[model samples]
Target: MASHSFQTVFAVPMTCGGCAKSVSDSLYKLDGINKVEANVKDQVVSVEGTAAPSAIVEAIQATGKDAILRGSGSSDSAAVSILESFFEPDARANQETPDDGVTRDVRGLARMVQVSPTSTLIDLTVHGVAPGSYRATIRQTGDLKDGAASTGGIWSDQGAGDGSGPRGLLGSFTVGPDGRGSAYINNPFQIWEAIGRAMVVSRQDESAGPLKNDPDTVVGVIARSAGVWDNDKSVCSCTGKTLWEERKDEVERGML
Candidate 1:
């Protein structure tokens, strides 16, 4: 893999050694990266290697932490592409698992505007989430056809954002006093293959207070692309004669 000596810095809120380890472990696994350093005292991570600033930031996010670009050694020489995603909330009918102590007052939407044969752009908007740190991740689905209404169901990390570190690590987000936040990421995944899968916004495990923690950090679902909904050929096949087609046929001969 080609590498650059670009050094990028980010401000992250790390509470202890474990949090720093999580950030390092997730970031070191990416290609083109050589070194990862996190200073808990400074609440910052300085990365040195040949990875794009955006990709490096994303890798750090997979660990349930947020990475913000401070400065890059290469300046503006890097080019990044962004694809849009479908945004929505999780299924609400299941309720298979209790939320533990997570608040459900939040509503969020995710969108992947476009995708190539193997990659996509993930954009998100969150409102009403308690102001703090949260994780956004994509998970393997058990049987849910649509992620938008999932109350509780089977979920496994889809591996990594681009098969490199972790899928659930779409990136970390923070809600402000207004209880809103937003994030954008470029990830590696096939949009079509991800349709039946699920994406969730979860509270950081360490951040969970008084309430016991469970997998229910889940907040909302990620929307699926338009193609996923249009796959059923029987819905609008465009081949059969419709009332409009028949009416036109009759009108041609004044049979109406």
Candidate 2:
């Protein structure tokens, strides 16, 4: 078997020794993986083996954390490419439409459907919207898909959103003549956020106090929600509190 090794950066909220072990064990389960070494202090993981990078990433994701392949190598580079491949360009380019119809901008119409261990697919519908170039920001939180938790991380149009400075455009979506179209953005932020929100809701339902001593879940939720606020930059007034404080306040007020 051809021997290959590569390093990937993961945004892991490893608050304790147990959390680090959990992440390591999860990565070690991939096929063709010879060994998995994680640096809890630096949030980096190095995998050695002939396994495909995508497979490794999928395995890590199955553990309910976000990871991205970084560094140099065919495997690492290819992994990034595979992730980016999920994004599809405009289906109906340069199409004209009626001037008096209600138009839903691209960002407003895009719907996030399925988020798998390694991928997220969003469906965008342009029905009943006017035709024009609309910009939108796609952001996400870092948490487990099934777990009720939150984390922080956001991926938006390269240069078309709140933080885009002169290059960023506000949230918008385009409408076509047929009023139907779609776009897809692949990143780890949204997955994390979904997981974090679920965690918050779960704890809320259980009547559990705000996450204390649970650094992973706490940081995860804060990171995720912060991303949401950043997309607009108006919410929270950009305070960007830590996960612990946010949880404390929410729990005290009976809010998750």
Candidate 3:
């Protein structure tokens, strides 16, 4: 199905008009993009498209420049969740380590953008984990004190289902041999409906019941994300670090 178009803002370093034109041309080559605007002075690029934000970042990076997502969608249309694995200290110590000797509790990230009143786009990305199939779902509560166990049952939209089958099945995706995977999903719900809820990706299927005590299962609360033009800070006020500096830290933490 064709996804509804929304605007996404990206921070890209550009020194001149030529640089701006080059960035614009690169984005134009991508599918689902309808408009591209590159501002050299501001070092920012604005794109209107149905393409996933990851795809846009990849396209911009193809030009040998880094692309940082400043914001996406409009107003309160965007949301995000940082999926992390939860386990006991002993169990965590027993898990396999990465090749680089870095232990990452974070497994994936889910970016949600509401394009229309009834449809929302979810850009799910996972990395640094076992290569296998996993189910993605929205849970009823945001509590994570006990991990997935405290998140409650699957969340279903009012009057949408017959209440007989899997309730909040967003879908399933598979991680690859390189321990990386991504899925662009469209769900029949608005952004507001999912805020403060919990998103879980697990090795179990929908019929397996609530995910708990599973070392591989990852969960996070869905939180609001900044929209297009809503965030303009080049430096984080809390950490006092430049955006690129923070990006480097994120990279080390296995956040691709």
Candidate 4:
């Protein structure tokens, strides 16, 4: 593996050694991949490299098998945010909708890993959204009481800004006509500093200043996620569903 490279674990359904071999061989063709280990007995594939986790999952899925990211980096070095729209919270005040339902609110997912003490890698993916450029920023607070508006101003680890500093910008990505977008960003920030903060992905242009009440915006709280070998449950204790079963539901909802 390259210097500062981290390992990522994925749960893939493998029936035999051949299945494992096929998966490993496919991963070896990808750039930045230093090592690939596939275990049929455990139906798990572990990779150590500088490649984006999203790309790793894509390569594994291309092998005719579904792959779910079990973990990444190490304990305390990884985080995740499930970005969802809060456009009509009052209209659906009493309605409960599953993420995979026809009216799913999930718009994107962000996976963050601290590669160095001063740097982090963010693998961001968005689906079922408008086709346009989106700017992502870390908000000062995790409050979502009024959608993105309630999240406050942009967060800057380099001290406060006069409401228009670039330090708070985490960079931007463009969603294609397919209503999907993906970006592997290398930002100068640690994962721990972002925990409990709010992440806003807004369709509004950055030149327009901080987005206030942008209906096309999606918001979510940054939370600590499992690291390599930190998660091992085969089935969700709360949902009573296997890992693959849950993956299927996510894919069906355009989360792939």
Candidate 5:
């Protein structure tokens, strides 16, 4: 079966912990509702599990309160968010050959999207490539080759299930007369799993072996939950924290 994990947020009015408990109890009783948390300070309730958005909204209404679908997604902010990253210059994430020592360049754009509860899609648009066929892969780190940070590497070709099996291929594209094209793959993994990784396009002939060591290949970032951070003040009282507070922790811990 396909993954059914989903997250839905509702605007619920609560005056105290008792109100929160009431809302939580009502939502928790519903089938497929894995986690139901209420925040009285934010006047919102966040539900995570396999339940549908409409059903979740209805369940919140059953508590004799109003429920608005403020957010519906898979994990965190990426559940319904679209993220984008760009390829680097030094990393062989591109295909460039010099003509009489006049070296050309490749430009790339990587997009990560959560199309459903259990699946995410990686879309790539690459330009300035040599006129030929090429393959793309998602790696563990978004760092470049000999980049200022740690050098980059690929986890597997198992992004869209069309490459090398199990570890499916992300997808392939052929450079056109304009030296650019687009490709996309629907990955079985969640958006969170790939949001912080690297996406690299390689030569079709295995001439570059693995993308990590390919001098012609470049490494670009795969950012997660790119948007939806506007005026978002939702908080967890149990942790006494909001997303901003958590980010502060990451910054202090050097995890961001």
Candidate 6:
């Protein structure tokens, strides 16, 4: 059997459990599909099998949602590619890594990272720290990859406590003098909840005013959710460009 793995980002937003289940059910109908996992929270879908990438993309698009494949590899090469992509420049630039050597990056946005079926104990390294608090999240992909029955979770730094929170998807790890540690996401639901909470947190702002049923508030929430934050400057990164500037750039690039 041909095996492949990759990650992608979904243009559409998946808010609730029902929305996730609907997409999962829709993608399970394709041929040559061995397994399908969906992380509604992370807006990712991971697949493994001999299916063509184009076919997988089509199946997802057919469900009225937008999907993009970020990377892919076949057989043994697939595993190497998946691991390397985790530390790529583009991926690293998108996340906030402390100068103190605490780096956290999101892998397989719309796909769940998977290991061999028999493998357990997802090992991870936290480079550059000496016993500090951290949290991690494990996300699974839905039907975006060709259908494959594979699921894997990565270790994250969960502040304090036994790393049990939300859906038991949250985990805590302490780095030794060598700046390395490990954790695991054993249950599927735990992985699901971790991704879900991430989706919600990525779009939420605690500093924002009280939630109301007003349309303006809804719009504000959407804008804030999509907006990026600069920890060093502590301001809205979106403010750097004007609406017309963005539109002009998009038009110039034929994106408009």
TM-score of 2: 0.31
Residue 97 miss distance in model 4 (angstroms): 17
Candidate 1, residue 3: Cα displacement in angstroms equals 19
For each candidate in turn, the TM-score is 0.39, 0.31, 0.88, 0.87, 0.44, 0.29
In candidate 6, how many Å is residue 237 off? 12
Candidate 6 — which residues are off by over 4 angstroms? 1-12, 74-256
- Tens-digit per-residue lDDT, 176-250, candidate 5: 877666664556676666655666676635444443333335445565443222335557567878655654553
Top model number, TM-score? 3
On the 0 to 100 scale, the lDDT of residue 103 in model 5 is 24
lDDT of each: 0.51, 0.35, 0.84, 0.83, 0.55, 0.35
Q: Give all candidate RMSDs, comma-separated.
A: 19.7, 19.2, 4.3, 4.1, 12.7, 19.2
Which digits, one per residue and each the tens of the lDDT, describe model 6 over residues 1-256?
A: 2243233222223677776676667667766566666777666666654454445666776777655443343222111111101122344334544144433231211222333342212223333333454444332322111111112222233532243543324345554555444333233232212332221101112237421211111110000111011111222367776433544553343220
- Which 10 consecutive positions of candidate 6 have the poorest summed lDDT? 216-225
With candidate 1 superimposed using the best TM-score fit, by how many Å does residue 121's alpha carbon deviate from the native?
A: 0.8
Best by lDDT: 3
Which pairs of residues have clashing backbones in candidate 3? none
Q: What's model 1's lDDT at 128?
A: 46
Q: Write the per-residue lDDT of candidate 1 for residues 130-226, one digit (tens) a residue.
A: 6777777665552223232332332334643455565445678787888666676666664554554556665645334321223234333343422
> Between candidates 1 and 3, which one is better according to lDDT?
3
lDDT of 1 at 41: 88
How far out, in Å, is residue 240 in model 2? 12
Off by over 4 Å in 5: 1-106, 145-153, 157-168, 204-208, 212-216, 227-256
Whichever of 1 and 4 has more lDDT, that candidate is: 4
Q: Rank the candidates by TM-score, best first.
A: 3, 4, 5, 1, 2, 6
Error of 1 at 220 (Å): 4.4
In candidate 1 the C-alpha lDDT for residue 64 amounts to: 81
